[model samples]
Target: MIRVVLTDIEGTTSSLSFVHDVLFPYAEEHIGEFIKNGFSDNPEIQEQLEAVAEESGVSANDLDGLIEVLQTWIREDRKETPLKMLQGMLWEQGYQSGAFRGHVYSDAAEALRSWHDRGLRLYVYSSGSVKAQKLIFGHSECGDLTPYFSGYFDTRVGLKRDPESYRNILDQIGVAPDTVLFLSDVEAELEAAETVGMRTALLVREGPLPETSRPVMRDFDEVDALLRKR
Candidate 1:
């Protein structure tokens, strides 16, 4: 029944600890050095640095102070665009250097492949920057799952918890809400998508099921079974 599958990253297709304990820390540790070393030549980083200065009121010349602000944002889990962009660059380096491989659950990798083979259009919707999203799937331990996905959406579209964001994604994807299945571990995000009439599934990869009317899936295997029934 569903033609499109939209998934969240952290706790949905990937483990939460992989993001929190691994990716986030790697970015935090390297952001300053990355900025210091590249600030002179990379216009892309320069632009984001300008954004950082404007948003935080830090002096544009205060590169060291800006680095400190970025480190703070990392610790606070702030969803600043500049922070996400810079982190993506650092992660790209990490991925290319083999410092870390993106984490995707075995079940998720298997099921996503099956869905793609069956002509279900797969997509990613995460708070992470689009670059970061691509880095993870494109350099995954499953050996580059990017081919399975058609598009990606990040906070640039809107906050995940906002219904309008789903509306925007639906508008861009040119799909009816009912024909698209949105999967996420976060109840708020699922509920937001549900508000816009999108099919919603809760991914409880670990722990007991929460109280919700939406279908609760233990893993992508369960999602695959659900797809067959539909």
Candidate 2:
């Protein structure tokens, strides 16, 4: 029996346009200013800047250079940890300012609540920072869905496409791999989870379903029904 449900955010429980069109643009527009306005004194920002410096082989004191590199990563949609952390910080500001509420699918929100009430341990595994993941769900259209999650995992654990990352998550969650179900819109991510012996379901919200051995669902309701039958 599946005891845990690990879900992706973008394109899984939420809309991809919100990430690409809304969040990314807001971050790209504000990041340079955010860094310049003395927010760098914040320890979290300092640590992420140090990480950026270490990863990019640049001087941490060169604030302009760091900003340039970060803007480039934002434009490229690079999944670097520092970039994700910075984006998360900016998103926190956006969420607080009411620029937009996180867009979760209606079906996903309903099914998530139902599953949580039914004694399933729900978790989120996304490329976004854990803080950002919480911000999105906490300020969601459905309102404060954060309490439904048992835990959150980000790229800090490891890349989603790396099987070792799923193993690491399984270790952290303290569950047998087969007792956890990984749900993602990305084929490679699902395959990586499967490589670690976890069950997987591909969320095909648009276009034709890909040719793959994994089970496919258009929404979480289908997933819940399918799981019940198993």
Candidate 3:
């Protein structure tokens, strides 16, 4: 019955090390410079700068203070919209400059192609901004995967841990919740998706699997198996 596959990016389709080790560090390294020089080039940069100022209770004129605050947010991996937007902008630079290609698992890329070929719609829902999500897939290690996805959702819709977010996605997709399979590495996210009546799967790639009542999948191949049963 599943017609749409809604997936998380960081730990589901890609490795956690890539996010925590490579992307975060790259963003932390370049964000300050990006903010300082980016405002004049793109109005969106200025907009996010103002947003960072407003959210952090810092003065708009205080660029250094804002940059410091943003770096801190990067270190903490805080899922704030302003931080995510800024990070996305910085990541776009990294991706385009050939600093690093986005790391997507081989299984994920193959399954995604297989799923799309099977006529199932694919979508991405991640804490990263929509722009960031696209850049990752667009310049992925497996070449461009952006063409495989039908749509993308970021924190702008809502946090993944909120059931209303799943409801919002379900509403936008215009499908019954049960017909969408939500894939994520976080148990809370899966629980939230289930709260909205969506089919949920736990994607655990490394470390010990959490004690989840929901079906746990090693990789996208297992997800293939799960989807076939329905």
**Predicted candidate 2 versus true structure: per-residue lDDT over 127-230, tens digit per residue:** 99998999999999999999899999999999999999999999999999999999999999998999989999999998987878789999998999977976
Cα displacement (Å) at residue 149, model 3? 0.4
The candidate 2 region of ten consecutive residues with least summed lDDT is 35-44
Report the Cα lDDT for residue 92, model 2.
Answer: 94
Over 61-138, each residue of candidate 1 has an lDDT whose tens digit, in order, gives 999999989999998889898899899989999999999999999899999899999999999999899999999999
TM-score of each: 0.98, 0.97, 0.98
Per-model RMSD to reference: 0.8, 1.0, 0.9
Give the CA lDDT, 0 to 100, for residue 36 in model 2: 80
Clashing pairs in 3: none
Task: Supply the TM-score for candidate 1.
Answer: 0.98
Ten residues in a row with the worst lDDT in model 3? 205-214
Compose the digit string of candidate 3's lDDT tens values, residues 146-172.
999999999888998999999899889
Assess each prediction's global lDDT (C-alpha) against the native.
Answer: 0.93, 0.92, 0.93
Task: Give the lDDT of residue 7 in candidate 2.
Answer: 98
